[model samples]
Target: MSGGEGGEEESLEFTPTWVVAAVCFFIIAISFAVERCIHYGGKLLKKKHQRPLFEALQKVKEELMLLGFISLMLTVLQGTLSKMCISEKFVTNMLPCSISDKHKEESAGNNTATMEHLGGLRRLLSESALSQTAYCASKNKVPFLSIEALHHLHVFIFVLAVVHVSFSVLTVLFGGARIRQWKKWEDAIVQQINDTDPSLGHAVTPIHDHAFIKDHFGGIGVHSSILALMHSFCKQFYGAVTKADYLALRLGFIMTHCKSNPKFNFHKYMMRALEDDFKRVVGISWYLWVFVIVFLLVNVNGWHIYFYMAFIPFILLLAIGTKLEHIISELAHEVVEKHVAIEGDLVVKPSDQHFWFSRPQFALILIHFILFQNAFEIGFFFWIWVQYGFHSCILGKVKYILPRLIIGVFVQVLCSYSTLPLYAIVTQMGTNFKKSIFDEHVQAGILGWRAKVKKKHTLKGSLTKPGSSSTDGSTVRIQLGGITQKDAGEIQPVHD
Candidate 1:
């Protein structure tokens, strides 16, 4: 009967209990092969100067990192599963062949009973491995994570991995596209400026020096072509080298101009605002980046899941706030411009327009909201660090996710409730956009950018003077920025 039972047990364990080890090894082998091929392939194509190959190398690195991340998750899942399904407390459960009996057997030099005990253990393991369905189908207490939870987490990780890979790939493709577009735009602008008569360009499209182009449109050949274009498309792509450049693409109400001063080139103010905000954001962003690197590398499953819960709101709010600013820039540019200023000397008129989004008060309100929101992000990691135990494998800690989220709500609400002398801060002073205030108050306090602020040069005896753009018979003296634009082109569209 025992022999028959042994045969049945052997039949039950048709597959190896710890086959995941072999799977891990196989995955490693495959990754290694792929990495080697990519690295070598890039080297081979270096002589041809195929720019795409460089990006491919970068993609390979990101892919390998993600693969390792996925592999680590799978390994953990497999190890826990194997333990729950096939392993048993063999030494403790050897009561039938008690320690005394084993000693006696050893003293008498009788090996038959000992061999039988070992054989029985093997059969037991085989039986357990084959009956793995029973473990999953019922409550499993062996692993820290319940079988249901483990599989659920595994599924989530799989989906997350897929999404992550897709995002990376899309970013690369989009980056390439953005590189092409940005280059094309630069070339067009250069051509337009070169072809444009300087006298006309000054009054309408200001023909600026190399410094102007360098300051504004990330001047041609100024940045590393390969590096700058790597992920130039998306400012949101955290690891992108050109994230600052992407951020610099927009300089909204930060480039505020007093409607009173025509000498105040919106383009010049635009450049200054761009530099200030870009620097401030880049400075502050490194902290978040460091946190991200640590967070990802640590990969604590419960903590990560908890983070995702809160981070979703953070990311969503960020995107929404950005969109709101863009809309405000378009619809209510005048109000924000008057309320926000870059110069210390220029006194702007109090923005009377109240209903729309261009209100200075609203801009400042949004700015503070964003500040608090960012502060919350920095605080979250610390909160997680303090509240939760870092024993990453303990899935029972997943229960804390919801409770902490509630606490976080309380934290946010409390923060909002506790009011400060914040009104003073939002009150747009002439010295608002200066560098000294950047880190202290306005970390990139850009609302949105103004496209084509047409400074209308209203001069003395302008309408009375006989000047017809249609006739082109006589030069018109429209005093602009102290420079006489002699032949003013067709009365250009003006910005109030």
Candidate 2:
């Protein structure tokens, strides 16, 4: 190439579209990381505290930051890309000519100058016009429905933000009330215990027996589970709900157990039922729906970048849902039947063991693998889109949409792959929470049974009384469940 040609090549201007793509990609990556941290933190905290509503509020704050950052990054990137040069071919071949003021002063008649300006203006209009997908792909490069879609997306997120804030306030109120109520009842129980048996009674029960309260309130799970359920219930009530059968099925499974417990308290039953509903909604419904909608929109627009944003979350939602189903079904089976240990690693009951080899568990693993593969396909598609878009943009193929499509896909795949780990981490964290309850305390049973037994033993009367004379005239320790007396007194079996 000659020096002049080299200079021309160096000086040749093109749109800075990659900047927009990069911004979007980074935003998605950061958001996924934040989301993972939030879920992991929730799991760690849920074990320590029963108030999940506070965690939900914290999640809302994180999501708000994500939305704000995404919106701002997209806006700035779009503005930068819009200012880059239109292709020279596009300017010369398609644009209308401008009417020079000098030619008009010279009365150059209806000739080349006027026609040139009109031609340049017409070509500008043509190049700027875009189909919805291409328009969105070329965002600021074109004029069309992309603006409306962008506006709508932001508007939807704003509405979501408002909803989150409202829910956060409601959660605080509900959690405060619930905590206060729990304290009140706990105090009453402690007072009763103190009045009846002065030795063992305390204001709060021992923390070591928290397993009892956990069983009563519902087992450990994501704080999002409860919030997700409340969101689903409102959605169902307002006729915006989906996955209705899944919700009902979970409810049925829980209620089946309730029917066998005639002494079940209504308040406890309702609280537990709601908690279960929340668990299902969070693991399966909320993230899954978000993934589907984002994927469908990306597909319809043919934008590779959006697919990247949608993919990992899509895979994660499926994986987490499968894990949850396995854990829940396994626990449900465990509750209904008593099983004997077969090997140290296995339990055998009348029905089959519901471990990894079981039909349901195998199916769940298969489903997770399938979702993972689908996300991989999305990454491949995004790569192809980006490669083609960059090539075409440099080659000045302004008339074709394929290049822009490729770039969008490239952005999608790049962004999705980078954040895939975070999604996996969050999904695994949620699964771990569900699994922890099973691992630590499945056969732990309710504490009230032991409490009742202790009461009965205490009422049987002291076998040794202070300063009471023993029949054998010897000091003996009086052990209730054993034959021992510490004082010099005969074993008392006084009538009640």
Candidate 3:
């Protein structure tokens, strides 16, 4: 308790104006560097740079929006609670018993005696929350200049994300890359499939996938990925596959792995499907990907130093777990399934099933956990909001708030983690929006990928008379005026 015991605590409630100006300049410079990196990175990779940049923008905007929006929410919440704790006389009613006398003096309008001796909002918090005060908040403070700067910054970023995501959605609705622009991609991708694996056994013809732009102006990558994941999850709960069927498939997929039926290709493809799904959901612009990852880590430091990180970790872990939860179940089942299908039918188990069998229950469980976690955090935040910090920011009360800009940004960033745009796309352009490798394996059901039968084949022709063989495995023949030569695999060839 070095705080009230008063050894070395000092109020660093403000910073010089020049430092704030420097930080703003730094942000602008960093933004310029980010743009250049994206411009060059896109050029070097031969990838559509616009899409990635747009995706990165989308991430930035959403997080900033969340940071700003949640900050606003916390501010509003704090203000309301603080007002409630203010008695009719304007003296705070949340004061502890030890400070009751001082509060009474202030309430009694003792103009000669300063009420600063009441020790701010420290007197109101529950004992458990109060114990953290001395160790973490000994020199905690609120910087007016930094808070003002952060307020403006958060607003700018929030509005930007809201506008960016909105504009991207609008463009998608209007459509970006027209028929001529995107048709080539469809043909080229399908042509690649034809060239690589002709016997893949399914209709992989390029569906009319709508492209938002020739490059990535809109959040196409992120939007498409989001739509695909949602569709996949929704399919598991109802539709053709029941919850039971979904869980059963997850259960059976793992337990059915046996020595006799080593279907390595099936297992490989199934896991690859999961990997693709993961990429589809999370694959965004590398710039955005890197930025969020870095900030998420930075948020860890913020939590260690002051306040809390809200539901960031829980939200993130759940998001990832939702994508890959089936692996553990499937792999475990396969190990057991191998023995059952091979040597031991001794232990009763669900019969082996489709490679594409899904586990919606796993998804449901995760959703429930996330919901509960969110509810608990929200409840606690509300509780603390009402119980303490009558005149200061929530951080200034419950958590340390020294060095205004750092704490302000850190808290806002923490708020940002709690906000995410799970469903970014609202415009529906039919089946073209979603493409999943996971769905390709279901060969018989309603959503299965049935094989496409080929209509034309190569015609055989009558053989020609033999010609002289050349030294290099070519055929040389004497023509009316000169010699002619053709390579071994050439249909038409070298002239002499």
The TM-score of predicted model 2 comes to 0.26
lDDT tens digits by residue: candidate 2, 220-324: 333444543443333221222112212222233223322233222322323332232222212222453365455444442223343244344344433444343
Tell me which residue pairs clash in candidate 1: 251-449, 252-448, 252-449, 253-448
lDDT of 1 by residue, 45-101 (tens): 565544334544555466457556765776666656655532334323413234554
Error of 3 at 226 (Å): 35
* Positional deviation of residue 99's Cα in model 1 after best superposition, in angstroms: 42
C-alpha lDDT of residue 181 in model 2:
43
lDDT of candidates 1 onward, in order: 0.37, 0.36, 0.32
Q: Write the per-residue lDDT of candidate 3 for residues 378-426, one digit (tens) a residue.
A: 3323333433333323334433433433433332232122111111111
Name the best candidate (by lDDT). 1
User: What is the alpha-carbon lDDT of model 1 when measured against the actual structure?
Assistant: 0.37
**Model 3: number of backbone collisions:** 13
- State how far residue 156 of model 3 sits from its true place (Å): 9.7
TM-score of each: 0.31, 0.26, 0.26
